[model samples]
Target chain A: MKAACVENGLVLVRELPDPEPGKGQALVRTHSCGLCASDAHFISGGQNVIDLSRKMGGPYAALHYERAFVPGHEFVGEVLDYGPDSRRSVKTGRRVTSVPIMRQGGTHAVVGFSHECPGGCGELMLLDEDFLLEIPEGLPDDHAAMIEPLAVGLEHARRGRPEKGDAALVLGCGAIGLGVIAGLAMMGVGPIVAADFYADRRDLALKAGAHIAIDPRETDPYGPLPDFGGRRVNLIYENVGVPGMLQRIVEAAPFDGRIVMGGYCMEQEALFVFAAQNKRLNIQFAGGEEPQDMDLALRSIADGRLDVTPWLGGRVGLGGVADAIANLSGPGTPVRTVVDPRLL
Target chain B: MKAACVENGLVLVRELPDPEPGKGQALVRTHSCGLCASDAHFISGGQNVIDLSRKMGGPYAALHYERAFVPGHEFVGEVLDYGPDSRRSVKTGRRVTSVPIMRQGGTHAVVGFSHECPGGCGELMLLDEDFLLEIPEGLPDDHAAMIEPLAVGLEHARRGRPEKGDAALVLGCGAIGLGVIAGLAMMGVGPIVAADFYADRRDLALKAGAHIAIDPRETDPYGPLPDFGGRRVNLIYENVGVPGMLQRIVEAAPFDGRIVMGGYCMEQEALFVFAAQNKRLNIQFAGGEEPQDMDLALRSIADGRLDVTPWLGGRVGLGGVADAIANLSGPGTPVRTVVDPRLL
Candidate 1:
C-alpha cells in the first residue's frame, strides 16, 4: 500500500505493507480524507506532545516519539472485508465513516495517529466494526469525510451551551471555527461573529453562516455587535490556538462569559486567573467528536441543511500530503484541503 | 472616627470623618469585622488591581490609587440610623450583616475598598439598606462576622456543582477553603480532602468537616483517596492564589475534572491551554458572595447546622489593624483575625 508516512518528524511517500484486519475490525478502501491542522501540529510537535502527555500521565503516553504513523482522522472509505467475530452490520462496498478509533482487545488506538492502524492517507485502513456509520446514498464522499471536523464543531457548540439571545464570537475562521459557526447557525444561535487574520478565511466564515466577519487586526471581535443592539458577546468559541490567545480571550471576554476552547494549542499558554475570576468566567475545554455529534453533522450535511461545499478546497494525493499540511499554516489557507489516495 | 486606613500604600491609624449615610443607606456602628485575604491583596497590590481593572474596563476603574480606603468587608454590625429614602426595615440598634456593597445612586462601591464607603474596620460605616440581613438571635458577633467568608464558600460550592459520590480536593486550607469544606459537608457531599502547608490550617479544615487533611509536601492532594475506594479527585477547589497554582492545578486535575477557582490570584498567571483542552477540564472562576449565598450562610450558622467558631482567631482593635494585615501573608497565620473598632 502506498502512503504518506510521518517518520523522524518528516513526512515521506513510501510503499508499506497493507494493514490486516484484527478481530472486530473491518478493512476499508480509502475514499477521501481531510488534511487537519492537528496533523500539522503532530508533524511539528509530536515529540513534545508525547513528552507532555507522558509527564501528565495522559493517554498519549503510549505513543513513541520515534515511531512512524499515518496522520489522517477525518476520513471516509468503502468497506472491503471484515475480520472474524465482527458485527458486520454494514455490508461490504458500502461507504462508511467511523469515529476513527480502532478497538484492539484491551487497548485501543486512534486509527490515524497510531502506526499499528493506517489511516485514509493510505490505500487501505482498518476501523472498528461496531463504530462504523454507513454514509447515506446521496452524500458526497468529500462531505462524508468532513463529518469528523463538523462533529467537533457540534461538540464545541454543545459544550458552549449557547442560550437564547446569546451572542457568539468565534476567534478564528479555520475549518474548526467554520464548523462551529455552522453548528451554531444550525442550532439557531444568531448574530454569530467570526474573526480571522486572512480576508479569504473571513469571507469563508461569512459564507459558512457567520452574520459578521472581521479581521481582528482592524476590529475587536469581543466588542459590542451592532446586529444584536450592542449586546456583548457572552459566548465565545476559541479556535485560535496560540501561546497567548487564552490569556487574551480571558481579558477580552465580558463578565460571566462562557468560552469553549476547540483549538488545540500544542505549546504552553498563560492566563491571568485574577482577571478570569473577577469576570466570573466559565471555560470549557472541548474534546473530539462523539457519536451523536457525528450523527448530527452527517445528517445536517446530507439533508442540505448545511452547505459545506464552500469549505471544500483543492484536493491532493498521497504525495501532496506534506505540502497540504504545510499550506494549512500559511497565509490564505483554505478551510479544508482533502486528500484522495488514488488522485495521483 | 478613629480607624486604620490604607493611605499612600501604608496602613495608618488616623482620625477620619465618620461615613455619612446617603440615600437608601443605613449607618452601622462597627461591631466586628473579619480580616480577609482579599484585604491583604488590596493593601499590597491595590494600584496594580486598579490598573488591570481599568485596562479591562472593569468596575474598579473608578477607584483612585492614592486615596485612603478602609480594608474590611466580612463584617457584622449594629444599625445606628437610616438616611432619607432608606428602607429602614431593621430597627435602630439591631445587629445586622450585609453583602458589603454600598449603593450610591446609580453607582455602587464595594464597602471596604472605596474611600467614600468606610467598611467595618472604621468606628462607623454605611451600607445599602436593601442589602442588609439581620443577624439572628444568639449568633455571636464573631460568628456573624464570618458569614461573609462562609457565604463565599457557599458560592464557590454552588459554582463547583458537586454531585453525589464526587471526590473533592481543596488546594488550600485557609478560612475560605475551610468554609468550602463546611459547605460541602452541609450539602452531604462526601470524602472531602484538603491540603495545606500549615498544619494548623489543615486541622481547621478537619474541624470544618474535611474527611482527610494532608500536607501537600508529604502527599499529593489530587492522588487517589482511600475513602472513596481509590476514586480520583474530580472536583477541585483552588484557594491558593499564586502565580503558578492555576497551571499546576490544570496539570494535576483528572480528565473531565471540574475546578472552581475561589482564590483571587492578583498576579498574572500562565496556563498550558493544550493540557487543559486535552483533559476536557471545566474551570469556573467564582466571584464574591451573592444574596442567596449570604442568606444560606447566615441560616446555616443560626440553625447550628454549620459551626464556624473554630475559624475565629485573635481579636484586634483599630490600632492593631496594620499588624493583622501584615500577618495574613506570613507563616502560622490564623484562619481569620477579627477587628473590633470599639475595643480600644
Candidate 2:
C-alpha cells in the first residue's frame, strides 16, 4: 500500500507494509485523504509554523505521545477486512468516512478510523466497525473526503443554535470556515456574511452561500457584515482565532448575539478586548469535531441539508502534493481541497 | 449656604448663595453625602494624564466636555422646597435621597450636581423630580447618603441575577463593593468572598455579609474564593476595573459564570479580553445607578435587606474639604465618607 509519509522534513508517498485487523477492528484500504492544516502541526519541519505543544488529540496514542508520528487523518476508505467478532455496523467493501478524534490519543487505529478504542492515520489502518458511516450511493470521493472537516462546522452551527431568519457571520474562510457557512445555511440561518483577508477565499465564501463575502483587504468588514441584521450579525461562527479577530466579531455582533468559537487558537497576530465589553457578547467554544458530530454532518450531506460542494475548490492526488499544501497555506487558498489517495 | 468649591488646584469652603428651587426641580438641603472615589480621579490629577478624546458616555461625559465642573453627587437630604408646579409625585419637606445622574451635557439639573447634571453633594442641590427616592424614617442620614452608590451594587445584582445559593466575589471594596456585598446578601447569594487591596475595605466587606475577605495584597485569593462555590464563584461583582482584575475573576469563575462590571472603565485595557476568552466569561457593564434601580436599593435598605454602615468610615463637612477628598482617596480611609454641608 502507498501512503503519504512524513520523513526528514518531507511529506512523500511511500510504499508501507499493510496492517491487520485487530480485535473489534476492520482493515480499511484508503480511497482519499485530505491534507489538513492540523496534520501540518504534527509534522515538524514539514510545512506549517506550529508551536508543537498544542498537538491535537487523536487515535494514535503512543505516537501522539512520541516524538515521531505519521500524519494525515482526514481521509475516506473502503473496509477491506474485519475481526470475526466485530459488529455488523460495518461491512467489507463498504465506502465510509470516520472522525479522527481520540480520547487518550489514537493508538488502536492505523488506517481508516475506529469508534472502538481509538484511531489513527497511516498506510494501513485498523478501524472499529462502529466508527464507519457509509457514504451515500452517489456522493463523489472528493465530497466524501470532506466529512471530517464538515463535522467541525456542524459542531459550531449546532452550538450557535442558529435559527431560521438569524443572520450569521463566519470569520475566516479557511476550510473549517466554509463548513460553518454551509452548515448554517442548511438551518436556513442566513444573510450569512463570510469574512476573510484573501480574495480567493472570499470568492469561495460566496459560492458557499454567504450572501455577502467581506474581504477585509478591500473594505472594513467590521461595519459592513452587520448592516443586514439591523445591528451586528445575530450569530458569529468564529473559525479564526487571531487575537483581535474575536473582538471584531464581537463588535460586529448584535445585542444578545451568540458567538461560537470553533477555531484552534494561536498564530493570529492582532488582538483587542474592549470591543467585546461594549457589545455584551455571549461566547462559547466549539473544540475538535467529535464522532457524533461527524455523524450528523454526514447525515446532513446525505439529506441535502448541507451543501459543501461549492467550497470544494480543487481536487488532487499525491502527485499534486506541493501545490495543495502551498495553496492551503499561502496568501490565499480556496476554502477546501480534495485529495484522492487511490489516484497515487 | 457654604459649598467647598475646587478651583485652580485649590479647594475652598466658600459662602455660596443658597440655591432656589427651579421649574421641574427641588432644592434639597443636604444632611449627609458620600465622597466617592471618582472625585479623587480629579483631585489627585490621576485623570489628567490621559487623552479624553475617546471617552465613552455618562458622568465621564462632563470630564470630556467641561473642565473644573462641580463634583459631589451622592447625598441624603430633606427637600426644602419643590419648584412651583411641582407634581404630586414629589412633596416638599420629605426626607429623601437622590441619585445625581441626569441627562445631557452642559445643562442645568434639578439636583445641584450640575457636574453630571448636578449630583447630590452640594450644600443645596436642585434635583430633577425624577432622581429622588423617599428616604425611610429612622435610617441614619449617613446611611441614607450611601444609597446612591449602594444602588450601584443593587443594579449589578439585579443584572447578574445572583440568586440564593450562588457564589459571589465582590472585588474592590469601595462603596460600590459594599453595596454589591449587601445586595448579594439580600439575594441569598453566597458564600461571598470580598477581594480588595486594603485591609479596612476587605474587613468592611466581611462585615457587610461577605463570608470571607481575601486581600490580594496579603495573599493570592484565587485558591480560596473558587473553593467557596465548591468550584468557582457563580457571580463576580467587579467594582475595580484594574488592568488584570477582570482576567483574574474570569479565570476563577465557574463555567458560565457571570461578571457584572460594577465599576467604571476610565480607559480601555487588554486584560478584560484575554481572560474573557479562556473563561468564556459573560460581563455586563452596569453603568451608574438608574432611577428605578435606586428605588429598589432604597426599598432594600428600608426593609433592612441591605446595609452600608461598615462603609461609612468617616464624617466631615464643607470645612473639612481637603480631608474628605484625601480620606476617600487613600488605602486606609475606612470605606465610605460622609460630608455635612453645615460644617462649612
Candidate 3:
C-alpha cells in the first residue's frame, strides 16, 4: 500500500505493507483524509510530545518517537474486511468515519499517533469496529472526512453550555474556530464575534456564520459589541494555541465568563491565578471528539444544516502530503487540505 | 469609634470618627467578625492587589493603596439605625449579616476593602440595607459570622456540580476547605477525602464530615481510594492556593474531572495547556458568596443542619485584631478567630 510516512522529521511517500485487521478491528481503504495543524506540530516536535506524555503518564505514553507513523485522524474511509470477534455492524464497501481510537487490550491508542495503527494518510488502515459510523448517502467524501474536526467544535460548544442570551467570542479563525462558529450558530447563539490575523481566515469565519469578523490587528475582538446591548461576552471559544494566549483570555474575559479551551498548546503557559479567580472564570479544557459528537456533525453536514463546502480547500494525493502539510504549517488560506490516498 | 485599620501595610488599633449612614445604608454595631486568610493576604500585599485591580479595570479599581481601610468582611452585626431612603428591612437592634457589598451609585464596593465603607472590624460600620439578612433567633454571633466563609464553600460545591455517585477530594483543610468538606458531606457527595498538613486541621476535616482525612505528606490524596470503589476522583475542590497547585492538579486529575479553585493564589502561576487539554479538566475559579448562598448558609446553621461551633476558636477585641491576623497568617490550630468590638 502507498502511504505518506513521517520518518526522522520528514514526510516521505513510500510503499508500505498493508495493514491487517486485528481483533474487533475492520480494515478500511482511505477515502479522504484532512490535513491538521496538530499533525505539523507532532511532526516537528514528536519527541517532546512523547516525553511529556511519558512524564504525565497519559494514554499516549506508549507512542514511540523513533518509529515512523502515518498521521491523519480526520478521515473518511470505506470498510473492506472485518477481523475475528468483530461486531461487523457496518456492511463492507460502506463509507464510514470513526472517533479515531483503536481499543487495545485494556487501554486505547489514538489511531493516528500510534505506529502500530496506521491512519488515513495511508492507502489502507485498521479502525475499531465499535467506533465505526456509516456515512449517510449523498454526502461527499471530503465533507465526510470533516466530521472528526467538526465534532471537536460541537463538543466544545456542548461543553461550553451556551445559554439563550450568550454572546460568543471565538478566538482564531482556523478550521476548529470556524467549526465552533458554525456550532454556535447552529445552536442559535447570536452576536458571534471572531478574530484572526489573516484576512482570508477572517472571511472564512464570516462565511461560517460569525456575526462580526475582526482582523485583531486593527480591532480588538474583546471590545464591547453593539449587538450585545451592554451584555458581556459570557461564552468564549479559544482555538489559538499560542503561548500566553490562555492568560490573555483570562485577563480579558468578563466576570463569570466560560472559556472553552479547544486549542492544544504544546508549550508551557503562565497565568495569573488572581486574574481568573477574581473574574470567577470557568476554564474548560476540551479534549478530542466523542462518538456522539461525530454522529451529530456527520448528520449536520449530510442534511445541509452545516455548509462545510467553504472550508474544503485543495485536494492532494499521497505524493502531495509533504507540500500540503507545509502549506498548513505556516499562515495560509486553506482551512483543510483533503488527501485522497488512491490518487496517483 | 475604635477600629482596626490597615494603614501603609501596618494594622493599627485606632480611634476613628463615627460613621454616618447615607442613602440606602444602615449603621450597624459590630457583634462578631471572623479573621480570614484573605484579609491577611490583602494586608500583606494590598498595594499589589490594588495595582492588579487597576490594571484589570475591575470593580476593585476604586481601591486605593494610600487610604487606611478596615479589613474584615466575614462578620455578624446588629442594625443600630437606618438612613433616609433605606427600606429598614431588619428591625433596629436585631442581629444581622450581609453579603458585604455596598452599592455606590451604579457600581458596588466590597465592604471591608474600601476606605469609604468600614467593615465589622470597627466598633461601628455601615452596610447596605438591601444586602442585609436578619440572623435567626438563638443563633450565636460567632457561628453567624461563619456563614460568609461557609457560603463560599457551598457556592464552590454548587459550581463544582457534584452528582450522586461523584467522589470529592478536598485539597486543603483550612476554613475554606473545611467548609467545602462540610458542603460536600451535607450534599451527600462521597467518599469525601480531605488533605491537610496540620493534625488539628485534619481533625477538623473529619469533624466536618470527611470520610477520610489524610496528611498529604503521609498519603497521596490523589491515589486510588478504597472507599471510592475504583471510580476516579471526578470532583476536586482546590482550597490550597499555592503557586504550582493548579498545574499539579491538572497533571494528577483523571479525565473529565471538575476542579473548583476556591483558593485565592495571590501570585502568578504556570501551567501546561496540553496537560489540562489532554485530561479535559474543567477548572472553575469561584468568587465570593452571593446573597442566596448567604441566606442558605444562615438557614443551615439556624436549623442545626450545619454545626459551625467546631470552626470557632479564639475571641478577640479591637486590640487583638493584629495578633489574630498574625495567628491566621501562620500555621495554627485556630480555624477562625472571632472578633468582638465591645471587648476591651
Candidate 4:
C-alpha cells in the first residue's frame, strides 16, 4: 500500500504493508482525500501549543508531533472488505466518508493524527463501523470528500445559532471560513461580511455566499466598513486564530452577540473580558464537528443547498502531498487541494 | 421623601421632593432593597471602560458617574397609589418587585444608575407598569429583595443548560455566586463545588446548598481538590472576574464544559482561548437577568425550592448606606446587607 506519512518531521510517500481491519471494522480503499490547513500545521510543526497540550496530554508548552504518522482525515472511500467477527453486514464497494477516530483500547484516537492508526491518505485504511457514514449514491466523490470540512463549517454555524436575516461576519477566508459562509447562506442568514488578508480567498468567499468582503489590511476591522445597513453583527465566526482578533470581534459585535471561535491559534491571547461583558457576548469555542454534522453536511450538499465546486482547487496524488502542504500556505494558494491515492 | 444619592463620590442621605407618578405609573413605597456590588462599583467609582464607553457613547475609557445618582436596584415595594389616568386594576398596597427601569422621554433608563431617575434607595419611587411584577403573598420581604440577583443567577444557569446530576463549580461566593448556588440546587445539579477566599462566604455557600466549598487561597484552584467522588466539572459559574481565574477554570472544566461568566471585572484580562478551544468550552458572558428569570426566581422561592435567608444580613437604614457600601468591600463582609427605607 502507498501511504503519505510524516516521518521525522518530513512528509514522505512511503510503500507500506496493507493494514487489515479489526473486528467491527472495514478496510476502505481511498478514493478522494482533501488536504486541510491542520494537515499543513501538523506537517510544518505549527500545531498550537494549547491544543497540542490538551490533545496529547502533556505540560502546558509547545508539543512536538511524533514522527511517522499518516495525515489526512477528510476523505471519501469505498469499503473493500469487512474484518473477521463483524456482526452487521455493510456491503462492499459502498462509498463513505467517516470520522477520523478509531476505537482503540476502549478509547477514541484520531486516525491520521495518531501514529498508531493509519488514515485515508494511504491507498488502504481501516475504518471503525461506529464512525463510518455511507455517502449517498447521488453525491459525487469530489463533493463527498468535502463533507468533513463542510461539517466543520456547519458545526460552527450550528453553534452560533443564526436566525433568518441575522447579520454575520466571517473573519477568515480559508476553506473552513468558506464552508461557514456556505452554511450561513443555506440558513438564510444574510448580509454576510467576510474579511481576509488575501484577495483570492476573499473572492472565493463571495462565491460562497458572502454579501460583502473586506481586506482588513486596507481597512480597520473594527472601523467603519460595509455595514449592509445593519446595526451590528449578530454572529461572528472567527476562523483566523491569532492574537487580537477576538478583541476586534468584541469591538464589532452588538449586544448579546454570539461568537463561534473555530480558529486554531498557537499563542496566548488577551481577551476583552470587560467589553464582552458589557455586550453580553456568548463566545463559544468550537473545534471539529460531530458525526451528525457530517451527515447533515452531506445531505445539504446533495440537496443542492450547498456547493463545494468553487472551493475545489485541484486534485493531486500521494507524491504531490508534500508540495500541496507547502503551497497551501503561500500567497494565492488555492482554497482546497485534494489528493488521490491511485495517482501515486 | 428622603433618598441616598451619590453626591461627589459619597453616598449621602438627603431630603427630596416626593415624586408624583405620571400616566401608566404607580407610586411605590420602598420596603426592602438589597445592596449589590454594582451599587458599590457605582458609588466607589469603579465603572469599566467598556461599560462607560457604551453608556456615554464616547472613546474607550473608564466612565465617572455624575453626582446625585441613587444606588439600589434589588428592592421590594408596595403600590401606594396610581398615577393620574392609570388604567391598571392592580390592587393598591400590593407588594411587588419591578424592573429597575423608568421611562423617561420615551426611552427606558436604569432607575438607580441613571441620575435623572431615582431608584429604590429612596423612601418612595415611581414604577412603570410595564416593569412591575407582583410579589406572591407567601414570599417574605427579605427574600423578595433578592429576586433581582437571584434572577441573574437563574439566567446564567439557564444559559448553561445543565442536565440533572452534572458536577458544577461556582468560583465566587458573593451575592451573585450564592444566587447561582441556589439556582443550581433548584435545578438538581449536584456535587456542586464552590470556591471563595473568605471562610464566611464559603460557609454561606454551603448554606446555599453547595455540596462542598473550597478556599482557593489555601488550595491551588487548578490542582487536585475535593471532587465529591464526581468527575470533572461540566459547568462553571465564574462570578470572580479576575485575570487568572479564566485559565484556571479552563484547566478544570471537562471536555465540552459550559462556563457562565456573570462577574463584572474592570481590569483587562487574558483568556486562554486555545485551551478553551481544546476543551471545546461554551463560554457565555451574562449580564443582568430578564423578567422571566425574575418570575422563575420568585416562584422557586415561594415554592420553598430556594432560600435566600442565609444571604440576608441585618437590615440597615438609609443613614447606614454609606457604611454598608464601605464595609461590604472590607474583610469579614456580610453575605448581603439590605436597607429598609422606612428605617430612615
TM-scores for every predicted model: 0.91, 0.73, 0.89, 0.73
Interface quality of candidate 3 as DockQ: 0.61
lDDT of each residue in A190-258, candidate 3, tens digit only: 889988988888888888899999887898777778766755577889998877899888888888898
lDDT: worst 10-residue window of model 1 chain B: B326-335
What are the per-residue Cα lDDT tens digits for candidate 1 across B260-341? 9998877777676778887899999998789998999999889887778777778999999998988875557678899999
Q: Is candidate 1 or candidate 2 better by lDDT?
A: 1
CAPRI tier of model 4: acceptable
The 10 consecutive residues of candidate 3 chain B with the worst lDDT sum are B324-333
Report lDDT per candidate.
0.85, 0.63, 0.85, 0.77
> Candidate 2 chain A: minimum summed lDDT over ten consecutive residues — where?
A48-57
Tell me the tens digit of each residue's lDDT in model 2 across A1-344. 55555554456666665656666667777676666664553343222122221232123322332222345566677888887776757667788777653322333333322223222234456555667778877887667777888887777777677877677878888778888887777677768888887778887777767888877667655454444645346777877754466555654565556678776553432222333443445566564566777887788767776566765667776666546655566564545665666665
lDDT, candidate 4, residue B296?
88
Cα TM-score of candidate 4:
0.73
Query: Mind giving the per-residue lDDT tens digits that candidate 4 earns over A1-344?
Result: 89988765688999888888888888899998888877765544445552546653533222236556677888889989888888535578989888777776645667767655677688888888877898889787878988898888888877788887567889998878988898888788987888898888888889889988889778644443445553455788998766788877776677788899988665667765666776688888986788988888888778877677877877899999988877775566777889989897
What TM-score applies to chain A of candidate 2?
0.77
How would the candidate models be sorted by lDDT, starting from the highest? 3, 1, 4, 2
iRMS values for every prediction = 1.2, 6.7, 1.2, 3.2
Q: Is model 2 an incorrect, acceptable, medium or high docking prediction?
A: incorrect
What tens-digit string does per-residue lDDT give for candidate 1 at A1-344? 88888887788888898888878889999999998888887777778678877888755667776777777899999999998887888999899998978776665677888888888888889999888989998888998888889888888888888889899999888878988998898889988999998888888788878999998899888878777798878899998776687878888998899999888888777666778888899999997778998899889889887778877877999889988888885575667889998765
